[model samples]
Target: MPHQSTAPPTRFHRSIFARTVLWAIIIAAAITACLWLLTDATIRNTNQIALERAVDLDLAGMVDIHASGGREELARRIADRIALQPRDGQLAHYLLADTAGRRLAGDLRQWPGLHAGVSESGPIALPGGSAFARATQLGPDLRLLVAHEDHDIDALRRQVALVYVTGGLLATLAVALIGMTAAHRLRTRIERINAAFRHPDEEALARLEKGSLDRDEIDELTRHSSEALARLGRLAGAQRETTDQLAHEMRTPLMHLDNRLVKALAAAPEAETAARIADARLEIRHIVRMLESLLDIAASQARRGDRHGLAPVDLSALALRLGELYADSAEESGHTLKLAIAPDVMVEGEEMQLTRLITNLLDNAFKFVPVGGTVELRLAPGPSLTVCDDGPGVPLADREKIFDKFARGSEPGTQDGAGLGLALCRAIAERHQLEITLLPSTRGACFKVAPQARR
Candidate 1:
């Protein structure tokens, strides 16, 4: 299995869209509330001042009437003013009384219950509403009260407040909807860039839209990243070409030399000469094997995700066959080769590469395991192939490094050829989009081949 990140996502990785939306709502609500408060204060203050001025006009008119014709004329003028009062929403109250508190003449029925003098400058509660009232002592025996009814002002404020809240709520909802839509588009574009970064291949980079001066930082990053990927792709292509050429060009000469040595060994007469010729041939064969393994590794690595010649491979049958082939060799070496492959297991791959992957793992286990050690091959439902041996298990430090080319295990066996077996195995597994892991075991090495985890 591929390595997985078990670490928790930090604050930055959490749903930033949600946080942004929440903050937006808070700010919108706050702004809306502040606007409402300012408007309400202005409306209340301006209306109060206007109503007070009208009260002053009414008070002056009554006071002048009293100054010219005494209290009786003042009461008569008050009645006339009330009779001619316009039917507008603004209402004015008038009250006149003797020093003994008897109603002389006015619209009000009785003196408003209030502190004697100062209460006139403040709001006084009326029967069905409230009013600003002012009282003036006309003479030793008479009093005058002028007041303005302002209940409509209170009602207007309430209606306006309700409207403001409604508008604020609607505006907030609209902003939320717009924010969500914009965030979704942003996340989509960001995820595409993130996916491109994850692959970092020229093909993936080309799919990204090019950035211009009009765009933001993300697009600029994409533009630079595409250029970087192109450079990397070119470098990788050159490296792959070099490796392919070296592996392919060296093969003919190596085979020719091996063939010449074989003939030389056959024609040699003395035992010593024959032995030396055979050793030379063996060395040639080892070199030839190393070159072929290197070629396989390079080819598989180059074609990692190319499923051009892939077909449905019956892994169960293949594992069974390889198990049978190696069973005799295991027995000859005084070891048991146990096969636990499930039936009808299958995978999509090139059979030849899969065969090499399995054989390399088996060869590796055999090389390390002592005589009489047991080797177990398990092929379960995951198309998982695990090769276990009762030999020296891989050292803790060398587990990850052993997959690299020319890297050998801690336990050096006598036949540790060019250490390309595990590397080739990893390449083939990667070509099939699989992962090969060195599982921890109590006794010997246990290598498991399975599907790579989706990050």
Candidate 2:
């Protein structure tokens, strides 16, 4: 099938770090508001208590002055106290009133309308700004009012507000920093774990070293992944050994059989007998080729994610050279070969393996194209390679299946192939971290081989 690329859907809350930071900010704001309200209420209560205590002290002083020296002495004492306080920044006001609610003497101009006992009065217009008065009854016919300027309490409130605001901002910043740091660490660890899974070899496992005993979720994951990779390595090793032993055991007998068939054909005198011997030898040779192809597939699969043998290869040059080498064969088969390759298109891969991969693609294209049809090999930027032929395109139903070993296209009987060509191509592409897929074309087949990044 023509490969189709689908992008993963995006979600807003995908990042754990972002979610954590958002929640942290919300919680911090709530806590900050609650603390501010509590602190504000406590400070207001304390201020009120201090103001009331001062009023009570003033009332007591006025009563003592009145009892000791009568109204004349009481008025004189009040005037003296008022005079002692600074006029420009007076915080306290005192009012002495008689039975008829007339101000006797004090800084206050009139008797405040209040019930008997201590009562608070707000923002009463004063010379500077505003004042709050605390009134108390000193006698059956006498009343005393004490007022303090509101600026002092307002200043105190402002200071407390500043502290609350500063604290709230610092707390929010600290929370954000902590959340970001934690998120970064988590993402890094997750990426490392993903890499280990992609390359499940001893080196990848060794890199996922055992963490501390008091392990977190990430550490535990690493531990488990290491164990899994180790197990996978053992299994792969066993499979490779088995493949090697089977190849050896099978190829030895096949070699002996081929030798016996050759000797039989040489000894046969009759033309019919010699023809039968030749047919058997051809079948044996086909089996031997199948075995070799199978071994190549196994080796390619085993080398996936292993870069030890990789080196820089000029893919453009390789494609052009192969096209030239196969030109004579194409002409012999009554097909035209064309090359449109750009120079200096380098890639990191095994040169021998990459050559085989390209060769297989070109061979398959040539095999399917009819006489007088054109097979073109093109190399372009992104280090992409393509082999296109004006042949019957891959059927939609068989496109995906054609990459499987022993899978044939719709016109299978028209072509002579073991059908492992595309499968081997896929194996080689995977080993080099490349992508190979059939591209949709209107009248022909176009197979693309390119780096994964390009895909």
The clash tally of candidate 2 reads 2
Q: Considering summed lDDT, which 10 consecutive residues are worst modelled in model 1?
A: 1-10
What's the lDDT for residue 236 in model 1?
A: 68
How well does each candidate superpose onto the true structure, as a TM-score?
A: 0.69, 0.74
CA shift of 213, model 2, Å: 6.8
True-structure RMSD, every candidate: 6.0, 5.9
Clashes of each: 0, 2
Q: Model 1, 1-455: lDDT tens per residue?
A: 22232222334337687578777988999999999999999998999898888877777778898899988898888888778877555377788988777888887888877444443566777775788887877877878998888757778999999999999999999888888787777766666666665555555666764432328886787677677767766876798889878877887787788888778777866898888878887887898888888878888997786554677888989999999999999999998999998998878888898899999899888888888899999999776899999987888778779889998766555336788999999999998889899887778889999998879
lDDT of 1 at 438: 87
Looking at model 1, residue 213 earns an lDDT score of: 38
Put down candidate 2 lDDT per residue, 1-455, tens digits, no spaces: 11221222324488776798889988997899899899889988888777767776776777787788887898898888889988778887878887687888887777656654655454467766866676667677887777776457778878988988899899998998898788778766775676667656456567776441337877887888777777877887899899889999998999899999888877865998888888888888899888989999998998786654567787878888898999989888899999999987877788898899999998888777788999999988776889999998788988888889998876665457688989999999989878799999998799998777633
Q: In angstroms, give how far residue 444 of model 1 lies from its true place.
A: 2.8
Error of 1 at 449 (Å): 5.6
Q: List per-prediction Cα lDDT, in the order shown.
A: 0.80, 0.80
lDDT of 1 at 231: 78
